[model samples]
Target chain A: MTDTEKVIEIQVLRYRPEQETEPVLQSFKVPFTDDMSVLQGLQYIKDYLDGTVSFRWSCRMAICGSCGMMIDGKPKLSCKTFLREYYPAGLRIEALAHMPIERDLIVDAGDFITKLESIKPYIIPKEPRTLEQGEYLQTPQQRDMYEQFSSCINCMLCYAACPQYGLDKTFTGPGVLALMHRYNADSRDGASAERMDLGYAHEGFWGCTAVGYCSVVCPKGVDPANAINQNKMNSAINYFTRFVTPKGGTK
Target chain B: MSKRRPYVRSMDGWWKRDAYFVKYMAREVTAVFVAAYAVVLLVGLVRLAQGQAAYEGWLAALKSPLSLVFHLVLLATFVYHTWSWFNIMPKTMPIMFVGGKRVQPGMITGAGLAAAVVACLAVLLIVRGVAS
Candidate 1:
């Protein structure tokens, strides 16, 4: 429409379960500004060209973590990836890697939801207190122990980036492990023993071969690699000391 | 009974697909060389325990051109293994709280590498002093 405005071709991987057995790429030329994100480009295609092109997004600022997809074969938040950076290149967009495509750019996240729930992401208090009793207090040091891991927004980007999770869905993945560490590291939480089966299992920390790409692709800096590897030490210790220590003494 | 059929994509040649995965594969492969060198050293120790003739025979075998090239490749992979091992040392250990602050990861890796270098040098110096 304009002489100076720039447009780039975005090849989206389309899948409709009822219509297509396999996913195929559909290209759309989108007019873009330098500041436009990949998510914005998909929005343009959905709004102008194809209303049936489905994807997920909420907060455009990368906080809601619903807009992750495979941008040029890497798991990334479409809201954070700028289209200008990949301009003039053959930009391929697909549903997140290692996930089943529901339709278009949306992938089924039920497995991830199940894994997240199994980790028990909330803090189980060390002791019970009466209603009239004062709230549990924490020092800055206590909060610092698990503060970085608490930043995960359940984006599932790390799971897409994890090769172990791709190869075997049974392995409890980086996001869940990081949240497990988050609660375990909390000074007031005492449920680590309950979660030890997952932490020390063959499908737990040992499943990770320390590929460490999960940390690289993490949008929230949760560093699930760090979480998984740190738990390797816990698992190793538990492996040797379990014979001596009584049950419910993993801490 | 269920409508869900999750298409599981095969990840064959996944290492070849991306540079990140290629580097990861390379790092993982270093373990092979490390194990090979361990076996070589173990054989040498066994030869030494056998007798002087057996020890000299093993030394002669080690001096062959093929063995030299193999050792060179082993050295490269061992160095890579050391570098990668040191890099991930911080991740494997519990978080260090020094003076009410978390220690930086770079510091942990740097300290580990420095300690390794010092230990290697100390061993070399001791071995040379013993020979002299």
Candidate 2:
């Protein structure tokens, strides 16, 4: 709103189902403060320049995991990415890669939600615990077994960074795989046998070629590639054991 | 009906656009060298089965300048494969705790590399002893 306010051009991909056949880049000049984030920059454009330019965002602090977008062609949380860093060079904002773009800067996340649900994200108790038995207890060491994988917020940036998922949607993908590992690694959980069926499948961990971009792009440090690759080893061992195990012992 | 036509992007050749992906592709390409080395060894074994004269001819071909160049290239790729393999090995394994603290990935990679060097040296010593 001031004469000296620094202005930067943000080239955002716009897609309107009623109008355009495909997404196209639409440029907007946004005046931003040094502390302003990319999400704030988009908000400024929506409030002042164009009300129609739509994007998803919630907690502005990267925790909500709703503000993921491709900033300069890399998957990133728009809320966590500062506008000042990309200043002078500006930035190109687009929907997360691989997934279908539902609208401007918004990818259809229905597939991800479905995959997340399929993993059985909740802990299936090893032993039925009654109210009198009290809440299930866990040692610090037990918590550490799955703590790293538990940090995934379902942002799907790992999915965006994954070429395997982009090539084949049938692949279980990274974020969901990490969530699967989280429950499996938990000591109190007895669903490992059930989850191993999915993990050992051809469409599961075998789909990942270990391109490793997933871990690098993950904002939560969830390292879904680690989870997926470790499961690949488990799958490999299980694969060899299936032939040797007693007839009815194998799944 | 809902007005929704979600646009899907192509993944084919997408790695060509990024340096990170290019490096990853290069690492993957190293597998060709491993396969080639295996094939060459298999040919040597076949030549040995054919008799001493055939084995000598096979060894002579390996000593040629072109084959030496291939060997050099294979060596470089082998080095890269070893380094990258150890770098990722820590991630693919469960966390190792020593003294109740998780071992660092860098430390794990360093240990793996050290083990590889010691094994190579032991192999070299055994080969030298056999030649003597």
Candidate 3:
């Protein structure tokens, strides 16, 4: 609003179910500081320009993983990505690729949520330890197995980046599979054999063609590609050794 | 049924949209050249079993300039295949832990490529030994 203040163009993909049949790019010019994020630009648009602009955000610090969108054809957290990076030029924002757009910059995350729950993102101890049995202890060495994979924030940015998921929604894409790997790699968890059944399915680890773009777009450094591909080897081994080892081989 | 219509974006030519995807497609297409090389070797093997005259004909074909060009193309594709195969080895394989620390992905790729070079050299030496 000042003379010295600079303005930037933000092109947002708008999709209102009642008003518009399909998503359309709507442009807005907003004044912003260097430290302002792309999320803040959207906030400015909502506050002054257009109130109908709908998007999800909470914590606004990348932990909630809600404000994920395609910023210039790349899946990134709008909260973490600064507006200065794409300033002066036209900054195009769209709902995450390969997902059904619910509204402006909001994709339907129902599929991702369902897949997350289906993977059972918690440990199922072999023998249920009661309160009397103290805690399930894990050494630093054992923790190293699943440490890298455990950092996933359930942001579906990796899903947005994955082509296989775009081609086939049935495939248990990157984030959920990585979370499944997290629980499976736990030393105290005995349900890896159970989880391996899901991993062994056609829509599981085998579905991944190792494009590896999932890891590149990850904000949490989750390396979902490594998780999925590693399980592919595990699935291959289980398929080969199933006859010899009883109970479908060890996890 | 609910009356909610969500717009799903068309992913047509999505691979062409990103350079990373184009690289992946290129890597996948290398398999065709690898299969071609296999077929060439198979043809040579079949000719050897047919007769001495047929075997000599195959060898003469290999000496042609066109065949040399084809071989050069094959070599180029094979080199790319070898590099990409090792580059992705760390991701496809299980994570390596050394002395309670995780092994670096670069180290894994470098080691795989080195092993592949050694194996290729061994195969060449064995083929030379068989010839002389």
Candidate 4:
């Protein structure tokens, strides 16, 4: 590397069970061009100074649903975040906030994945049919209702930003709730009755205190807060209507 | 048992270290404070319903050291509840637009707090007028 190339200082949070009780900042001077990302700098360190430094990444292009970390206290995809943005002072990288740290720059995301499954993440039609029938038709407006939520790559920056999720582990959180909203809004899905039962509980929509950090940190503009809050209205209506409406009233 | 295993653990105390988890804990803790203030108001109402002599006795009790300590704690909780309520209010309600531009969250919270202060002052004035 030439002297003309800018040298950026990267400070990463490190934790090892045998050596450290909690994460600590370890800084490294990395030589970089304008095109280098924070992920590349960490890779450089791992390849050179410390082979044991741990993190997660797969699709360097941001599609593989990995390489999420807290860059300067904000949850972001490390592969997409460039060092040029924090030019002079370098960068500080850590694992996603509000999740258990398994090791250096990696958090255990089992809770989020479980909540996703609880909502029956797959489509369940009202009646069984074969492929011989035509595909379930949906209008453009119906597609528009859920188009924004469909963009979620499950990077989980929203989970890190959510204080409510951090406080109540059982609370079905922002990302998972957005996914639920996606399926619920689908015209082909016939599981609203079954899904509403899970979404209406205290541990579901009602648990959200609406800190709104989830919406702010969402990389895909999923707006999971909107999904959770809008569903709260649905849940409340469903609760009140249970007494008035008979079972299987409308198709 | 089936071969399928749930990917996430279903257990307690999982959220202790998460930052978002800590935020939710703070919100729940503030809720206790809100409930405590409600009880204080309910006690006052009961005293008033018992007539002048009973209300005067309740007022005297409120001036005692233990009662004063309780009031201090209540005051702290009420402040927390008020701040948290205002912070989350914008999320629940529809956005307020003026001249085709939306009002800022901080502005909305400030206006709400000002209205609360005015309402409290109006209640004090009415109470003093009725007593005299």
**Index of the highest-DockQ prediction:** 2
lDDT of 3 by residue, B1-132 (tens): 766788888989998978889999999999999999999999999999999999999999999999999999999999999999999888887778787678998999999999989999999999999999
Off by over 4 Å in 4: A15-25, A33-35, A84-90, A98-103, A109-111, A126-137, A163-169, A201-203, A248-251, B1-33, B56-132
Candidate 2, residues A88-144, lDDT tens digits: the string is 989999999999999988899999998888878898989878989897889898888
DockQ of each candidate relative to the true complex: 0.61, 0.72, 0.71, 0.09
Candidate 4 docking category?
A: incorrect
> lDDT winner among the candidates?
3
Candidate 3: count of backbone clashes, pairs at least 3 residues apart or interchain:
0
Order the candidate numbers by DockQ, best to worst: 2, 3, 1, 4
lDDT of 1 at A13: 91
- Per-residue lDDT tens digits of candidate 4, residues A1-251? 77799988999988875677667889999888889988998999999979989999988888777999999878998998899999897788888877887778888878888888888987898666689986777776667667777888988898887766766788888888888888888877888777767787777788887777787777777778777886777677667777788773222
* Candidate 1 displacement at residue A61 in angstroms: 1.3
Residue pairs that clash (backbone atoms under 3 angstroms), model 1: none
Please provide, for model 1 over A1-251, each residue's C-alpha lDDT reduced to its tens digit, 9 standing for 90 to 100: 79788999999998877677888899999999999999999999999999999999999988898999999989999999999988888599989988888878888899999988888878788997776888778898889889989999888899888889988989999998988999999988988888877888877788998888898999987789999998888788788887788763454
The TM-score of the first chain in every model comes to 0.96, 0.96, 0.97, 0.95
Q: Which stretches of candidate 1 lie over 4 Å from their true place?
A: A246-251, B1-5
Runs of candidate 3 with Cα error greater than 4 angstroms are A248-251, B1-3, B129-132
Arrange candidates by lDDT, highest first: which order? 3, 2, 1, 4
Q: What lDDT tens digits, residue by residue, belong to model 1 across residues B1-132?
A: 665555556778777766888888899999888889899999999999999999999999999999999999998898888888898887787778999878988999999999989988999999999999
Docking class of 3: medium
